[model samples]
Target chain A: MSELAIQTKDISMSYGDHVALDQLTLNIEYGEVFGFLGHNGAGKTTTVNILTTLLKPTHGKAWVCGFDVVSDSLNARRQIGYVPENVHLYEAMTAQENLRFLGQLSGVEDLQKTIDETLELLDCKDLANRRVGTFSKGQRQRIGLAQAILHRPKVLFLDEPASGLDPMGMKMLRDLIVKLNAELKMTIFMNTHLIGEVAKTCTSIGVLNQGKLVHKDTLKNVMDRFGDDETLERLYLSLNTQKVA
Target chain B: MFASRYIMTAALRANLRDQTVLLIAGLFIVLVLISAYLGWSATATVQDVYLKVVEAYAAKGQIAPPNPVPDTPPLGLLRNMATYVALIGALAGLVLGNKTVSGDRKSGVYALLASRPITSSGIALGKILAIIIAITGLLGVAALTNVITFMILPNFSLSADEWFRLAQFYIASDLYVISFGLLGAFFAITSRSEAKSLMIPVTIWLTVTFIIPQLTANVLPMAALNPLKAMAPAPSGAFFVFTQSVLTPISFAEAYRALAATLLDFAPPGFKFQSFISPMLTLMIVNGLLISAVVVAFGKMDASRSAYDD
Candidate 1:
């Protein structure tokens, strides 16, 4: 097994003439809450897609938990779970029903028990029997999180996890992210434009602008060098501006 | 295989909850029942009129002509079922097929499914299997209705040979509708817009069910309702010959109706034994080809880009 939780080598993805992700290289250690900051269409989701084995990079390679995202995609997928921006599910089904379906697809053994434990772990056991369509955005996100981690994946990918959430919802998600990373020892890769959430939750941060990574460092080093969320925000803006220029 | 099993179960549950699909399928089964009732009633009505004429001949102390109702095949009463299956049953299958894929895409669950340890082909196969099972269930109801009607209604009992023919008719019907379902799923996977996903297959269904038959067999639109109606031979000409040669091979509606007419024992005189066998072959081949196309289209689909095209 690889020491790194996730690794990529000059992965490039293009749709026709437009490149969604350029030749980019990256790596993250196990158990790190790595925040990927990028403006809309900066290829954050695209990167997550590649890492989750939902996509194959046009040129180059990626590995998740030592498994190639392309050639060994099924094994790579077995290691990771992903929640997209909005986190839609079968609305007519209950939260538990949706979770069970996805968990079975993941080939989780002891499925019923795992579903119960995962729901309890996410602190949303009350929502399990309720229909997903009837739940609020916050409630749905909790179910989504439960579904993603049902198989106990080694890595979890979140794309705009905090989007459309109220403050309390955001806090709950942050707490869950922390719990999964700290207690479960799972590598967490988050894609978001919210630097505030990154500052609060991510241990390491990388800034991507137009498919290019401009800055990457540990949160402590970035905080000591750049000083606080306000200064870090400025640095983020400046990096994007420079990349655009 | 495990992933596909669960996927199929989930899809079946989701489809059952979809009101639109339920309504369409329910309507189809209802139509089949109604067609059977009407067939029984028509037989009774003709029998009543013939009895009245026979009594008048007996009162005059004259000979009565033979009863015409005996010539009508017991299964022929349900001939409207062929048309119903061709039109409404195919639509139900199409809608079910569309929902099978579009539901995942619209709900944004395609990414989740795709990211799982299952291959896209597995996902496609699971969904296709679900369609096959659902269509079979629908046609099974229609077939049962025919059997029950035959048992209850007088002058409608079938011999063992006819019973086997009825079963074959439904199996062929199931395949015909399933072909449309696969067509719908193929378009749903390949097309971006939900409307296009549904519309393209419907257009093809219309072309196959109506236009092609007219061009090749010179079948009038109404004549198609009576699967046993003898096609009026078109004027012998180059255009007619050319169309018959080109379109006949692809005319599944004609194939299906020919097969149904033969099975129901209502075929026109001089219906060849070869015609009976060829339609079934055509249906099986078309289904095989459609299944292959659908699996290939799904395997090539980009999962990351699979989102609702509103």
Candidate 2:
């Protein structure tokens, strides 16, 4: 009964002669952890980039929080927080400074408190004063998350948030994502290749292959379609092979 | 309000943290010191040479040396130092501005910043302001050193008026350099590589500052002619008639005629249209045009495009 947080109608994008997104239509409801699965060049980043207003869509339209992504970009940008794949920070600045800088840019009032709360929420309060260049991969990931959620965005777009994290780090990030969705009532749109992570955390899922959405359903629905005998990993492999053939 | 302030603070901090910035500032200080010492030594040598020449002329009784053989330094040394300072300032601006605009793209910071709510114009403005502040600080230190050198030199009384005039010239020169620097930054943002951006500014600076000045001074004979000549009254009497008969406009014969007319009590020339305001106004207009072009180019820059690729 909740309204859709994101809606796209036959969206397509191309770069030069190459098609990046092929008439992909999708709808994600409010407060759902929507996992977007794709291979290396499966238009995942491209879709996110268009949704986040970093790139203009070549065709069709996308609506984020009831505002068109292209025509109402300022509203869409104000409504969503994006964490790019690479956790690049101002290496010269400390974690706290980076959070504060991003928080202000996101129009978060009481910037110092927001930075502190975000850092504390990520359990990075102790590392707040440390320069990002000195932090480990997991620490940088945590800081990146802190920056993304600093403004308490209605929807969070995370691109491979746990890409290079250790097992423990991955668990920690997964727990944080679940907590953010449940406690904050935020919609999560994540792009990743970690089927295990997606299976464990996602409430709804969409699989992209060769610039097209091949599968999309709730976790239970996807599991039912594949049956109990087949694992999600097996289903993914079989689907990818089908695409290749 | 707070967001803009935060962005500016971050930009200033980033610029200050850059090792290349520190290196450039250190290099500037070293160059200023070297220039000061060389200028001082050269001025002393010129005074010594003048003293020797005067003493030799007096010894030969060829001409009586003027009172006390005044040890006035040749004005050229001071003027040359000012010119060097301006040149170095331009070079510093080119390097710093190029890095400020293109370095972010090269380092992957541009994409990150662009995805945020920060506009391209805001980023460009913050960067340009930071560079201007840094360059102004460096120029201030150089000017202070120049003033101190003049004060310390023996028998070199640099009056307040002269100091003001020198400062005015330096400020004008700095303005010109900053304008070119902004142009360089714009080019760097648009160019495929930092080297191309840097080369364009340096080439333009060299052509305008060195080549143009040389050509204006030496090659253009019409530029040298006084505009007040048409306003001067015709000469009278036998002296003028005789000079007019002997002289022609094409040769130094005209110069001899003028001297003879002036020596034989011809009236002084009338008021001329010559004024420093015209050249100064032209320079200001040129600076405005360059700065506006740079700003417009910066405003149109697309952050998503790769700065390293054409």
Candidate 3:
């Protein structure tokens, strides 16, 4: 109902003495493919965790689909789906079984029909009955995407879903993300350190450096300012350099 | 509360498909049958020996050798299954439960499962329900096989009282078996590694099964159902009596063996259901607490945090 599908204000997270995310604030409109860019330990996943209502923020507030991340977490969870990094799911079970389990949790109706449709949509219909244990990494990613989209979430959160995939797998995932956003009218929040993937897939980008968001803007606007893809890298390095300075 | 059917069924399917569960369950069946066969053959041998001696006396030998003590109540002849329940049945349950959380970790599904709309308590309950089904199904089959074997063996038909006692014995066995399962699950979900979690339950199982038997007085083969064997030392001082009274309730294996013995009519020294009720209650309470602990542990876990202790 809100103009933004995801929103956060001055959220900070700490584990004992160390802070993983700090005063991070951002918002994404209903249909943007927002790419979260940061190196390891840059708080990208932490931010994704907060917005997905998985972790409560130590300071500030977050809202997913107009539900408070802490207070209205269940409703927030219902409105979003997550695919974590290195997500190997129910290897002993077939893809259909995995879908049934997660589908029921999401309260989907007619799970079997929906699963068929999802697999068809993702071009994984043939692999539906195969045990996930036998699946290649790329095939598992397809299943992951299928499950996340099974309930038709308003916002899908992906944590480095492209990290370890083969080149073809990455391309298929890219096309799938684009298709889900365009055809399903869904919003996407993708966490990645891979800027090239962002250039190819994400429309909006935010770069986090050392637990803080150092820069954020529309890709086109960023390209105009920096002049090219190579300068985008230069800009990112300069931002991290400024933080360390 | 979301429907746990999906999760519960998945877990049960995994349990059913697991080779270790199958192997342990198979071994339990074999041992139970072997124990029954041994009891039946031993009873037959005693009867045959007595008859032969009696026939010799009639042919002009001295009076037949005094008859060996006959096994009484007929139900006592069937108690080998009880001991199996205490050991193998418990291990079967233990093996099923210890893998629940660890299974998720190994399959890389905990993060995925935790992210769903369901509460962690719901997830924990689903897992517990699956274990309950797996263990019950396993032990139920073992019980059924024993009953069938008893019917087939000559001179081993069950009377009404024997049937009731047999049922009671199994209830006790099921309770004992489930407790170990819960204990193993507790460690699996709480600990950081498989080897560490595994060692805890097995160590306790070994301690309860073997070491404690050595330490107790009735330490004999058939009479030490209550392993404390503390009665003899009690005459020495009030301290021994007090200690026995305190420690008896904590010995689950002893409690189960004692309970099963009384129900089966072995009635080890001064055996009465009333005396063992406290220990049975302890077993029941411990099981309830373990199931609740699993639910609470999962509920309190920080799902938002990436990765498990594993």
Give the number of the best model, judged by lDDT: 1
Q: For candidate 2, write residues B16-110 as lDDT tens digits.
A: 77777668667777777787788778667766776788789888987745633234422223443443444565667777777677666665556
TM-score of chain A of each: 0.96, 0.96, 0.96
Show model 1 residue runs off by greater than 4 Å: A227-230, A241-245, B48-65, B228-230, B272-277
Docking class of 1: high
Q: Provide C-alpha RMSD values for all models, in order.
A: 2.3, 9.6, 3.2
Task: Output the better candidate (1/2) by DockQ.
Answer: 1
Instruction: Indicate which candidate wins on DockQ.
Output: 1
What are the per-residue Cα lDDT tens digits for candidate 3 across A1-245?
88889999999999899999999989899999999888899998889888877677899999988989888877888899898887768878899989988899889998899999999999999998899989998998899999999999999999998988988889999999999999998899999977778989999988898888888889898788776655666766776666521
lDDT tens per residue, model 1, A77-157: 999988888888999999989998999999999999999999889989999889999999999898888888998999999
- Between which residue pairs do clashes occur in model 2? none
Worst 10 residues of 3 chain B by lDDT: B225-234
Better model by TM-score: candidate 1 vs candidate 3: 1
Which is the leading candidate under TM-score?
A: 1
Winner by lDDT between candidate 3 and candidate 2 = 3
- Native-referenced DockQ of model 3: 0.71
- Ranking, lDDT, top scorer first: 1, 3, 2
How do all the candidates rank in terms of TM-score, highest first? 1, 3, 2
Candidate 3 Cα errors over 4 Å, as ranges = A228-230, A243-245, B46-71, B211-239, B272-277, B304-310
True contacts kept of each: 0.96, 0.54, 0.77
